[model samples]
Target: MSPTDILRLLLKNWKLLLAVPLALGGSLFYFTRHEAKSYASETTIYTGIASGYSLTGNSESDYFRTSNAFDNLLSLIKSRETKEQAACYLLASHLQLKELDATQLSWASLSRMRALLPAALRRQLTGPTLAATQRNVTAYASANDTNELYRLLNSHDPVYSVEALGKVNATRINSSDLIKLELETEDAAICRATLALTTQVFLAEYRSLRMSQTAAVIRYYEVESEKALKRLNDAEEKFLVFNRDNNIINYYEQTKYIAGEREYLYSDINKIEMQYAGALASLAAVDKKLAGRGASLLSSAELLRQRKHLESLNTEIANQQLFARQQETDAAPRTQQLQVQAAETVLAIRTTLNDHYAQLNSVEGIPSKGLLDEWVKNMLEATENKAKLEVMGRRKGEFMAEYHKMAPLGAMLKRIEREIDLTQKTYFALFTSLNDSKASQQNNELTTNLKIVAPPFLPSQDKGGKRLMLVAGGAFGGFFFVAATLLGMGLLDKSLRMPAVAQAQTGLPVLGLLPAHPTHPFKKTKKPAQASKLRDHSYEHAAAEHLARQVLRRVSAVPARPFVAGVLSPLRQEGKTTVVQSLAHSCNAGGLPTLALYPEGTDAGPANDYTRYYSPAQATLHRWNLAELTQPRAADVQLVLIEFPALLEATYPVTLFPELSLVLLTLKASRSWKPTDQQAVADLRAATAAPVEIVLCGVARYDSTDLIIPIEKSKTA
Candidate 1:
């Protein structure tokens, strides 16, 4: 429909609209009457996640770690375990409040019991102080949130407490650490008190758990450090003892000493060999001359060895001298030291060789006794050389064995030193770790990083602006509710309420709108025949005259002559018979010779159902057989008003019509005609070529008396 059409409809329902809003106002007042005033408060807290943590690690981190840190904190806040603890604390507070309130209630109940006692007895039982205290406690409970406290404390189920915990809302703002937590309740004090206590419990638990974990780690590190220190000490002691047993300082220098000893032993053997050889030569000469006066003794192996050592030392000294001369003082210190040692060795070996040569040269030609002495001396010297050679050989073997041990002893010593070094490094590392752990533990012991930058305060305004919003919303809601009820009802209703509504529903032109006749409120409506027994009132008479003119005009517009219009409806009690009787009276009175006929075998019976009536020229009423209705009409009748039983309810064959014009008489201002009944009207139109118009009865009255006409008062009792 166009907006104009909607506006017109609303205009027509203006009075109903007014009535609807008033009804809504009354309903709102009732609903809001006993409701508690609500309050709300919010708190902001930075969870330190968005700010980033002061953790000991690489300072720069991934965005996921930075961003999702608050998400972890939010989980902590909303955790079921945390909420459970909050519930316990809140429940305890509720119990305490309930206890205090219960005392007052108990006193009040006692006072009431005392009041029922005799007056003198009541005076004896009651005390002024007790009564005043009771009144004050009761007032305190009433003014505070003690009613909810009482209920909570009295409840047997723990589920109530669990459900109560749901009141807290922990909201993260835009996935950041900025959290807005709120508690909503009828009482502001309860909200504030509960949030404060719960926050304390949560902080204490969270901090304690974190610190405890750090402490455990610190203890573990301390144990490890102690173990490492012990291993370091053991390794160091093992290395020291090993070196003492070997009679060594450093393995490298000890090896050099063993080599020097071997060289010296060989040099001594050479010297002894040189001296012994000289003696052996002298003995051989004596032995050869004994027949030529000669002695027969041999030189020792030691003398031969000494002679070779002396030559080697001399050669080594010469080589060192040549090297020293080339580089001079610029020679390496180690090389210079080697040159000096070689020179000393050369001097010792040369002196020993000269003494041995002198000993051999000093042996003179001997007399018999002197020669014998020389022989004995030569043998003795040879024997001494032999003993010295044996001793030198044994000493060289021992020195050689010691030299062979150098690598194994040095390896063992180096291994112990390495173990000591590694242990010490480990111990130091563990110590550093222990210190770091202690620092971390201390840091953890500090307050939790979550800081409530802004704590919640007692709310100044009621939550949600609920009262004003509800009132305004109720007004808004009432408007739509009223619209739906009125408009929806209007659309769903197929009954004729106005001539326009009747025409719109059936697509039939409305002939007239007739006002309802007044009647006693408690009296049931009489049957049509009984109703027709009474003379028509002035309103009915005027309505009949006004409607008849429209009907005749409508008939004139149609191609069919002398319209034989039947007053019909889909169902009974739609005033079809009444319209037929009235229209017949009006037309006949207006000098149109009209006959009104009720169809045969219908609920409309014979004369027994009719009241005797006469107009100056009334429409003849009949209940004719079907065959007679099909016969030729009488010459005097100019118009015919036929009445039928409800067409859809009864089986009226469509072919029964004989050139009939149909007037569908639908009741106005009633919800009587269903959409299903309109099809019956369509069926009637399909069956007959004559124009079908509708008469809408009992419309709402509007005074415009200019078009009304007087009707003849022709009724007789």
Candidate 2:
């Protein structure tokens, strides 16, 4: 449907639009007029759990040195135990009453009993200091002899629970240290008191928890430090005992001494080895000389005596020659004689030595001096050298034995020294670690990081107003309800209510349209003439005039005599007769000669009168048979609008269409158009060669383009 048709539909049903909104909105506003007022209070605290001071070194570091502290604090803040305690605190401060004689307590009774408590006791019982008195009072009406009512209040349930925690909200602010606690309740004072109580209770719990956790951490450090200290002491004792067992004041120093001695012994052994080699070489040389001396040649006692005498004579002669050469007289006779005597003694000694060998016949003549010391004096010197060489060889052999024996001690000394160094390092490391742990434990005992910043204060404003919200919500809901209903009804209603729809559905042109005119539904007992006079013309007149002009445009196309049009609908009471009545009046008013006829109605006044109307129809109208309609029409009649019984109701309806030049299918525009209407149009189009056109009657008044004025709903009906 077009925008114009929708507007007309709304305008025609103006009562529905007005009634739905007024009924829904008015009823909502009235019932919700006295809604409960609420007041909200807020308090804020910051968690020190995320950041803290370093007690050990005081550089503002993470003192707890743990991952769980921050998480634990957040859980503690929102835990059920905390909420229950907060609720108890609130009750103790604000609603403490005498024992409940009844299952439920009244405010008046509470107020009366509240005066009996001492001021100090009341002050002490509120906030973080809530006493055992509150526990007993709250437990009075509890189901299991526990304060389950206060617990109920602290639950997250929307109803049947205490709303202290239910109405309260706790949350951490984004990217900040602050935690916010908000409480909203119907009673302003109660909400304010609850806010104070909850924050105080939370702080109290926080302080206690912090103390306990800190103490636990300190105790752990102390125990660990003690263990480390004990380990250090044991290490020191082990080191001391090792030194004692080794019989050394300092193992490290003793190891250095032993190392120095071992190095000295190694140097001495090296010198002795060189000396021993030299001694061995000297002994070999001495042995060679002894072999040449032929000690065996001197083995005989007689030879030994001769050799001794010769040695004496040679020494005396050598002394006399050395004395003569030292004399001042160069050519002295004595010097010459001494030289001659020395030569003579040397020759005699050799001759005697050779004679002895010759007498023994045991030696051959000796080789030259290069191969042997041929002088008797030189041979005796060689014999003495061999004796000294043998004594030195024996001494070297003893020293070598000692060098080999001390070689393994150097390795044993090095091993002992390494072990002593390692023991000292272990003791030092343990002592240092133990000291650090002790300092940490001490610092933990001395430091505390948690501190409260602010307490809860009274709220400045109450809760949100309900009346405006209710009114706005009701209007919105009512609008949606009406829209949904329109949608549902439109989905169910298949009738063609608009001209555009009828044309689109039937595939026929709507030549013209007349707004629906509900006949004077009020005059139940009126005669035909009286009812006709009473019918209103505001919508009907304007609709008929517009439709008749449109119909004439098509009728004028034929330019034939007796221009006759039949008006029909598929259903009874679809305003076919109304369309004809208004159409003829409209034609006559437009200066066209017109006659309106109802082919089957007996209610046309005065038998032959076509100008007089019956009970419900307005305008001069007449009834005719198919014979009268086909046989003759007034010579003055330029247009004749014939109204037929509805197609579904008419018997012999085919005979009524013989003289028609055009067929106008009239239907109420406000009513749903049925499938039968399309069939009826199809039938009429098939039955005659006349052009079939639809004229929708009773369009509503909504726009300047809408051709029909809307008829008002009866005020009484």
Candidate 3:
């Protein structure tokens, strides 16, 4: 359907569209009449989640972190625990009230609470002051989940419940750190009080939560720091014990001194060997001068004993110098004693050798005194050198042994030092982390910046109810809904509601349209004059006259004696009888002798001069011969309009097709064309060579006007 068709349909049902919306809107207004006026309270808070100064210094804002922070803040504000606490506080304040105070609660709300709370329970819970009442309420609420205070907070009551407090809305103002909180309730005092309490509770809870988080982190870092410190101390203690047990002080330095002393001792031994060799050679030459006497003197017991004693003292001093611990290096007295004993032994040996030489006489008996003196000095030098060589050799062996022992000690010491170094680094790292955590905790404390910029105030004026807006919305909504429903029905409808629609559906040219009229053309009425006036000026009469003229023009080409036009329909009640009667009247008025024939049961009231009902039995016997059926009126009739039974219900009389000049298919404008109707029309066309034109009856006035306009214009032209 076109938009024009839809517009026409809606306009035709304008009264229904108006009535439905008005009725729906009226009902809505009446039902919402008792809606109470609302009171609103708003508070603004400075929540520094995105841009805030802290002990940690200002940092660049992170979109994700700031978003998360705001999310957390909003979640905290809406949290059940926070609201419950606020509700508890509000309830405690109310409980402490001795009488209804406008500042605290409205009279109706106070009265409602009194009625809800038993007098005995109320007295038990109430206290002289707000603080005492809060304590009492807390204690009572904690006693059980089924307590009155608990139940009240959990219930859906509009004043003291957590659910009620959920109405408080917290939103960040644009991208700023400020938050706007709003709430509306039936009572102004309740609205203001709820918002105020909720803000306080949310701030306290947020601060506590932030502090707790930082505190937990600080505690963890502190624990790790303590562990790190203990590890460091343990490493140091191990090192200390290792040093004590190993008898070491500055192990590297002690080893270096030992190595230097060992090298010096080896060099001294080399020098002493050179001296002993030279002295021995000299002694040998002197001995050659004193031959057997020198040999006997060197073999003397005292001399041998002195030399052995000197070697023993030197060995002891060398051992002390080469192998003594660093702590033992302070034994200077003992070292000096050992060196003195060695020197004294060397002197005794020299004296004994001198005495032996002095008492000796040259075997050759030539300058014996000088020879003997030289021999004694050389003998003492050789003896002392030999003793030093022996001590130095032993010290070299001890030095090598000490060095080998210190190798493992060096590795162990390095391992211990490495442990201490690692532990020390760990300690410092944990200590730094602990300090950072402490700083963060301090920053959190400083940045708990929930400041109320605009505190909630009691609303004085009542915010009017939304009754008018709701009523208007309902009316508009109902109007749209009804319009949409009608449009959907129209789109889905397949009714041939217009002459164009009938022509399109049946693929037949429309002769004309017959507008729906209240007055039946065949029915006799008490007031004939009024009926005549109705038929004369009515659109239906004009449409019928036009349709009859079109049919006459088509049948004028037929060579039959009396032009027979068959009025047929797909189904009964398609106004086939009406069309036939109207066509006959139109023809008779136009000076054409017209005869109208219908089925036996048709309501063609008492046979008139131009109208008659035909017998089905005779028509069937005569094979629907128009001449045979209308033989009696054939002489007076120039145009015969025969109304056939619905073709879908009864078979078409193919015998009558040869006698008919034209066939008018009368289709109701409000009825859909079915497949059977199309098939019946096809069959009727095959049975006759006459032109089968469409006559749309019961058409809406607008559709009828559309069809009549062209005709009227053509006639005028």
Candidate 4:
């Protein structure tokens, strides 16, 4: 459907459009007429969530954290517990008042409260003071869920219920640390009292929660710090015990000293070994110089005894020197004494050797004294070096043993020290955290900065009612509802209500349109002449004549005589008989010989000279042949208009299609076109070669103006 059609449809249902909205809007206005006047009160508080100072010092505000904090504040304000406590306080304050107190409640509110609360119950709950009454109320409310006090708090009472207090609106003011709270109620005192009590209760709860959180953190840190300290002490104690048990007093330094002494002892041993080797070689050469006579002379007991004593003296001196060196003490005195004794012994040995070899000749013909002296000195030096080497080797072995023993101690000590260092670090870190938590706890206590900047006050004027807005909203809501319903119906409607729609639905050309006139063209009347005159001047008559002229023009195109045109409909009661009768009468009046044939059982009105009825079975069997079914008509008849039964109600006369020159598919403009109608029209077109056209019958006058000439205009022409 086009936009114009939609506009036309809405205009056509203008009465309904006006009626529905007015009814709904008026109903809303009437219902809200007795709505109580609302009084609103607001309070402003400094939340200090974004830029607050505390004991911990000021810091840059984080956008996300600040937003979350504000969200938490708002949520707390609306929390059930907070609202319930506030409601309890307000209720208690109201209950304690024996008479009207303007500061606490209005006259109207006091009366209502008295009506809600029985005298006996009110006395049972009330106390001497507001605080006492509040305590009593809290205790009574905690008794059970079904208790009167608890029920009052949970009920929908405007002053005492948690639900009523939930109306308190809390919001952050821009990006600042300020928050605004608002509430509306039937009474000014109730609005102010409710907002004030809610703010107080929420702030107290928020502070308590923050303080508890910080305390919990502090406690956790303290516990962890204690554990860390215990671990550190254990590590230190283990280190001390390990040191005491292992006899380790500076193990690294002791091992270092042992290593140095061992290196020195090895050097000394190596020097002594070289000296012993040189001495032995020199002694052998000296012995060779003292030939066979020298050996016999040296065999004397005195010489042997002196030589053995000198060797003993040298060995004793070397022993003293080695001992003194290892002990890290002065060995010069002992070494000198032993050296003197060894020198005396060497002189004596020399005297004996000289006496023994006085007349012995040397192997190279040299004197025997020099060779004997050289042998004696080499023999003593070799003996001393050998003894020194033995002593140094023993010392080196002791030093190596000490070094090996200290090696494992170094690793054990390192491990203990590492453990101690790690434990100490952990303990210190936890201690620092504990201190920070304490500081934060203190900061939290100091920064409970929710201060009411604008306390709520008793409202002097009542807030405006929403009656007008609700009425307007209802009216607009009803209007749109009706429009949407109409739009949906129009979109879903399949009725061919217009000539263009009929042509589209049927897939056939619309030859003409017929307006729905009150005067039935085929109805019988007592005064036939007057009925005919009335029908002649009707718009339906005029439209039918126009349709008949168009059909005759098309029929004239065919060269066949007695052109047969069948008028068919998809269903009964679609004005097919009227279309057929009007077409025949118009054609006959226009000087064209026309014959109209309708079904035998159909109500086609009294037969006339141009109209006749035929049996449906005969028509179907004989293929609608005029001579076979109807009485013989005038030979000059140029057109035969046959009105067939509804296609959906009876079988279509397919055999009659060969004889027809044209088929007019008549459809009711006010009725929907179904798939059955399209199927019937499709079968008819497929069965015959004749042209099929649509005549949209029973159209409103406004819809048919474009297709048919008006009766006035036709008469003037």
Cα lDDT tens digits, model 1, 281-348, are 88766565444322221133444454355345434443444335422545456545654654554454
Error of 1 at 380 (Å): 22
- Candidates arranged by lDDT, highest first: 4, 3, 1, 2
User: What's each prediction's TM-score?
Assistant: 0.53, 0.63, 0.87, 0.68
What is the clash tally of candidate 4? Answer: 0
- TM-score for predicted model 2 compared with the true structure: 0.63
How well is each residue in 72-145 modelled by candidate 3, as lDDT tens digits? 89999998888888888888888888888998889999999888788898899888888888788778877899
lDDT of each: 0.59, 0.57, 0.82, 0.82
Between candidates 1 and 2, which one is better according to lDDT? 1
Find the candidate with the highest TM-score and give its number. Answer: 3
Worst 10 residues of 3 by lDDT: 319-328
- List ranges where model 1 is wrong by over 4 Å: 1-24, 27-199, 235-433, 445-554, 557-561, 578-594, 599-637, 651-656, 661-717
The superposed Cα distance between candidate 1 and the true structure at residue 294, in angstroms, equals: 13
> TM-score of predicted model 1?
0.53
